[model samples]
Target: MSGNIAKHVFVMAGTGSIGLIAIFMVDLLNFFYISALKNPSYTAAVAFAGSLGFILSAISIGSSIGISATVSRLIGAKKRGKARRYAATFLAVMLCIATLLAALNFIFSRQLVSLIGGKGEALEGAVLFLRILAPAFPLLCLVMAISGLLRSLGEANAAMRVTLSGAVCAAVLDPIFIFGLDLGLTGAALGTIFSRILICANGWYQLSKHDILAFPRLKEIKPALKAIAPIALPAIATNLATPVGNLFVTRTMSHFGNDAISALSVIERSVPICFAFIFALTGSIGPIIAQNFGARIFERVKETYRWALRFTLGCVALIWLIFFLNQNLLIKLFHIQGIGIPIIHFFCDYLVEGYAFLGLLFVSNTAFNNLGFAFYSTFFNWGRATLGTIPFVLIGFYWGPEGILTGMTAGMALFGTLAYFKAKNVIHNLHLRFPEALA
Candidate 1:
C-alpha cells in the first residue's frame, strides 16, 4: 500500500538473503566436489550428506521458529527482560538438543546413511562427511537461535551480518580444505564446520553486547520452553515436511540409480542459489507481519503479504528466464556427466517453471507461522508430501525422473493454492475483528 513497507521488505531482504545464499552456495560447492571426483557414488554421497544435514539442522531451524514466535510476541508486548530470559533458555535447550543429536548422528552415522539408502563407498563417504559435520550442529543451533532472537527484535540486519559472515568464510575455506588440503569430502565438512564456529563465536559476542544473549536460569527454562513449545513443535513438524518429503524423493531417485539422485542433488542445491531472494522476501517480511498482527493492524499485514507475493513472483520469473536462456551453459558450467545431464535438462525444461508456485508456498508458510496459524502450515506441507508426493511419485516412477518432477510440481501447485487462500482469509477475518484497531 505504501513505499515505506516496500522499503522495509527490500532493506530486510538485502541482508537476510545473503545468509541462506551463502549456505546454499557452499552446498553447491559440495556438488562441485562430487563433479570433481567424477564418481556417481560420490555424487550420491554428497546428496545423502546434504539431506542428512538438513534433517539435523531442523532442530535448530524449528527452534528458531519457536524463538521467533515467542520473542516476537514478547518484543511486541514490550517484555524485553522476559524475552532475554527466553533467549537464554532457548540457547540452553538448543545446546542440549544439538548435543544429543550430534551424539546420535556420530554414533549412528553409518546406520543413518544406510537408513537413507546409502551403500558401499557412498555409505562410507557419507558417514565420514556427516560425522565430521555433526559437532557443528550445536554451534549452528546457537547461531540460529541468536540470529532469530535478533530478527525478532527487528535487528534483521545484525542477524544477516552474522550469518552472511559465516557463509563468506565457508566460501573462502571450502576449496582450500576440499582441494588445497586434498582432504576431499571430509575437507568440505571441515570448511563448513569451521565457518559455523565463526558464526557462533561472532554471534555470541554481538548478542552479548546488545544484552540479548543471557545466562539461563533453572526457573526460566520451564516457562520459556512452555511458551516456545506450542509454536516450536508444530513449526518443527511443519518444517520437517520439506526434508521428509525430500527424503522420500531422494529414496525414489535412488531406485533410478546414483546418477539420478546426483542430478537431483545438483538441482536441489542450485535452485536455492538462484532463488535466494524468494527466501529473503518471505523471511524478511515475517517479523513485519508478526508485529502488525500483534498490533492488530490487519491492513498492513495484508499489504505485507501482497508486496511479498509480487516480489517473489517477479524474481522467480526472472530466474526461470535466466536459467531457460542459459540452460546449456549451466549444464556445461557444472560439468555434469552421464544420466545426470539429461535429468538436469529435463528439470530446466519443466520443473524450473514450477518455482513461482513454490515461491508462493514459501510466502504463505511465513504468513501462517507469523500469524499464529503454524498448524495450517504444517498440514499443507505434510499433505503435499504424502497426499501430493506419494501417489504422483508412485505413478511417475514408471516414466522415470521426469515423471517424478511432474509429481512434485503437482503437489506444489495444489498446496500453494490452498496456502494462499487460507492466508488471505486469516487476514480478512482479522480485519473484521479488529476494525477499531485498524482505525
Candidate 2:
C-alpha cells in the first residue's frame, strides 16, 4: 500500500500470472495429450465438459471476489480480526454452494452435456468426465477462497505457490494416469480431481501458517453474508456471463460439426496460456485497488487503475505478435485437421487481437468490483455475453465458422470500449464524492 503503484501492479500481476500459467498449462496439456490420440470426439468431449466446468467454477470465483474485496478493505482499514472472520465465513459459504452445484451437475451430467450439443461418443465422454470431476468442486472452492485470502493479505508469492502445487501434481500424474494406466479420458478427469485435492490442502496450509483464517461462528455467518452479498452476488452473475456466451458459441459451432468444436477447443486452451498475465491482472489488481479505497486513498486508487490498463495493453501486444508468428506451429502441434485447420488459422491470424478488448473489460471489472459498484461489472459482462455476443455470432453464421469467430471479436471490441469508459467514469465519480481524500 505504500510502495510504487506501478511496481506493485507489475510484481503482483507477474507472480499471479506464473501461478495462473501453471494451472492453465495443465489444461492446455490435458487437451494436447487428448488431441494426440487423434480422436475428434475426444477433443470435442473435453471442450463441452470444460464449458460446463467454467460455469460451476464461476460460482466459487465470484464468492472469492467478495472475500478478497471485503477482507482486503478491512485490512487496509486496520480491522484484521473482522477480516479473518469474514474470510473464514465466506470460504464456508462458498464450499457449500460449490458442493451443491457439483452434485446437481453430476446427477444430470448427460442432460447438461446434451444441452450444450454434445452427442454420441462426445456426449458420453463428456458425461463421464463431468461425473468424475464434479465431487472435487468443493475442493476447488476451498483453493480459490484461500488463494484470494492470501492475495488480500498481500502475500502474492504464497498465493502463487498454492496454484503451483496443483499444477506440479497434475504435470506428474496426468501422463501416468492417462497413458501408463491407459485410462484415457477418464485418466485426465482423475488427474484433475487429484490436483484439486492437492491445491486445497496446500492452500489451507498457507492460510493456517499465516493465521489468517478463523472458524466462523454461527452468529458471524449472517452478518458476513450481509456484508459480502452485495459484491458476491453480482460478481457471480458477472462471471457466469462468459460461460453463458461460450455455451451459446459452442452450441452454434456444433452445427459445423466436431471439427469446428475441436478447433474452438484448441483456441480455448491456448487463450489462458497466452494471456495469463492479463487474467492475473484481474485478481491481482483487485486487492491493490480495494486496499487503497478502504484507506481513503482515492489518488492511489486512480493511479493503480491507470497503470493496470497500460500494463494490459502492452501485454496484449506482445502476446498477439507471438501468436501471429506461430499460427502454423500451433495448428501442427494441436494436430488440427480438416475444417479445424482453417478455423485455427483464422483465429491466429485475426481473432487474437480481440483479446485486447477482452483485457480492457477485465481491468474494468476489477475496478467495478473493488470500487463499490459490482453491479456495473455484472451489467457490462452480461451485456457483452448476450447483446455483444449473441447477435454478432448470429450474423457471423452467414459467413460460416470463421464468421462466428469474427462476430465474437466484434462484440468484445464494443463492450470492452464501453466498459473502459464506464470504469473511468466510476473513478471520476469516486473522486467527486471523496474530495478530501485527494488532498
For each candidate in turn, the TM-score is: 0.92, 0.92
Clash-forming residue pairs, model 2: none
Q: Pick the candidate with the highest lDDT.
A: 2
List the RMSD of every prediction in angstroms: 2.4, 2.4
In angstroms, give how far residue 314 of model 1 lies from its true place: 1.2
> What does candidate 2's lDDT look like per residue over 1-439, in tens digits?
7989999899878877898897787677778778877889988999999989888878888888788879987888998899888878877877787888889999999998899899999999899989999988888788778888888887878878888888888888988998899888999998898888888888888788878788877788998998898878887888899989999999889888888999998988889888999998887788799888878888898899999999999998898889889989988887787899999888888888889999999999899988878778888899999999999999998898999999999999999999999999988788677667532
In order, what lDDT does every prediction score? 0.81, 0.87
Clashes of each: 0, 0
Model 1, global lDDT: 0.81
Candidate 1: where are CA atoms >4 Å away? 1-4, 75-78, 291-297, 429-439
